[model samples]
Target: MSKLDWHADRGTHPDLALLDLAPESVDIDLAAVRLYRLGRVRAEMNKRDIGAVILSDPINIRYATGTRNMQVFSMRNAPARYLLLTADKSILFEFTGCLHLAEGYETVDEVRPSSTASFVAAGADIEAREKAWAADIGNLIAALVGKGARVGLERLNAGSAIALKAEGFEIVDAQEPVEMARSIKSDEEIKCVIASLRATEAAVADMRAAIRPGITENELWSVLHQSVIARNGDYCETRLLNSGPRSNPWFQESSSHVIGENCLILLDTDVVGCHGYYSDFSRTFHSGPDKPTDDQRTLYKTALEQLHHNMDILKPGLTFREYSDKAWNIPEIYEPNRYYLSAHGCGMTGEYPYLYHHRDFADAGYDGVVEPGMTLCVESYIGATGGREGVKLEQQLLITETGTELLSLFPFEEDLM
Candidate 1:
């Protein structure tokens, strides 16, 4: 009866759908998550004989200390803030005037004003500023772990690494230690993921509610963005919503094209959601007063089949290469347009240990074991070369001690199925 009332009779109203996904409010134990994450990083460091890890990546900073400030800006604005951690101490070089953000976090031992070395901030004095910033960090490391200790640095510039090396620290790439640590999720971290997914799927339902003929692609995609923010989620990591022909090649961002009577809308929810965990899943919908054409249904069915077959074969201890060997066979026609990864690690964001399709394995695949506590997204995109449309489907799963558990609960398009 109303514009947003598309699915009332099917009990698929956005409000009701959200209630189903999160029937009751969920509470995350922030302290537990923070401490568990910190312990994980330390354990990895110990394995590598690393005495300290210096982190500038906003994501790594959040992972290590559970404190955040202007993350999007800080991602590119190097040295906006950083974290230095040793076996016994944790220090946060917070953005100016943002010290209060980590006031009560037990994982953070000290919050000091960050010394920025960006060219934009320091101009001609950048080299000196880098030296000064490096000196300050060098002093802290010396105080905590002493000089010449092996230190890992993440997402830092080459200049900073040189400076740290000049400070008598043995610099190692921190990405490995950090990612290996993050590969496995703690129980509390899983709770944050579940909460984030509930919010994300609810946002998706609202996006679906707004879909109709003549709605511009941007208009439809905006609904998802608005709903995520409304639920206290941080942001959508990508603008990957597309309609009709744009769905065939994929990777076309949402734009101003108006939807016709029947079109395929594909979306990848790269949502960096609640508590800073990621909720990555994808689905394709049919916007219709007219039923989907035969070709559209074929694509949808093929993708669903690929997704389920791949998902069913996953379990703890499966080697990445072995998974590729057992992965669903892709038909020749769909080979050119196949999704790059059959599956990939998902946590704070799309992460390490990517599993490639069998045909592509030798070139891009690497070896690793899929262990318990890892969350992954299984992906499928089926569209024949030069076809008019495509179908994208993905499912997020958590690997448990027993087997795989489905984490994403968004329903597929039954009509298209």
Candidate 2:
């Protein structure tokens, strides 16, 4: 009989983090991510020949206006924080109650907090918050007029749109300001992502340790949930504890199938650390004292080799198609007809930037260049149908000028049975 072998693999590469992330919401330098955002906003304004930008997307709010509040969770919260940009200077106008930007003068020029929701509900003098909203954007327009540049809007959410319409201010749709900029990560962002990967790896190790025959998939999932929180991984988008037959289908789980001898435990995983930065990693384990079948060993080793081989090819300036096609080929050589997802973005969301599957005779939407500072979760899977089980090899990677680096280390054994 052979024992299951599990090991830790790198999740995010070192030298990937571009900023100093400490203590979560406080004392962290978001300058890198912020500057990148601002630069993109300005670029959009310049392209549209506009002078100012308005932001409404909550996700991009902190990047442009430096306003990170729980208010983002509430759609009722209007865009009181209107950032006015000029050639010589930029000013931000926000509701005053936000503590994070209470006195960040250089970053946020002016703030006006308002609690007009309950007032509006009562239909009383609810004009205070509304006036603040109108005034903030109105003031931004006035500031831009001072610069003599045609005011342009970099981005805005639907709430901001209503306010702009009420103010009779014409807003230019310039979504290009920050979407692509976020595609490329910064050193600080990479660092936070790496930390997230470390925490995820620890949690996965605990989950793997807890796996045994007779355990329910739900039970194993609970172990993973507890393990991740036990570490620094306080929150996660998905706590996948797929095992047994569920391991074959991608993203399969939420089942009650009990683990028996020779069962396969598939852990498709991720964890959030700083802000929304995340780490995604995957590993597979077999629950059994018996030796792995010839097919299991063959597929597992092939996936592992493909992981390392693809890692060697990680670098900057390559098109997404190049990596997808190149990386996919390695797994194809190993597993023949197995499923292979070369890489995907591992940031604020999982399944980001979409998967790298065959499209139009080649990879699609991957034409974007892989530049330095972009972090990706590259994975390869080998599985059979009808609960035949499978194995997945996944690692978090960051693109650097020199090459690629791994964030967390997962088990690297050729066989796990």
- TM-score per model over all chains: 0.93, 0.70
Q: What's the TM for model 1?
A: 0.93
Which candidate number has the best TM-score? 1
Position 256, candidate 2: lDDT = 86
* Residue 176 miss distance in model 1 (angstroms): 0.7
User: Per-residue lDDT tens digits of candidate 2, residues 1-417?
Assistant: 111111112221121221222334233445555565567666656766666665544445555644445433433554444455654455545455663343432345545443332343325545554455556656657655642334445434444345555665566664554555466666666655666666667777777788789889888878767776665454555646677667766577546888888866777776654455666787878887786787777768767776687777768877766766666454333344355456777665543454464432263454667777767777778764443677877888777888887776876654553
Instruction: Identify the runs in model 1 with alpha carbons over 4 angstroms from their true place.
Output: 1-27
What's model 1's overall lDDT?
Answer: 0.88
Overall lDDT per candidate, in order of appearance:
0.88, 0.60
Clashes of each: 0, 34
- TM-score for candidate 2, please give it: 0.70
Report residue 287 deviation for candidate 2 (angstroms).
Answer: 2.3
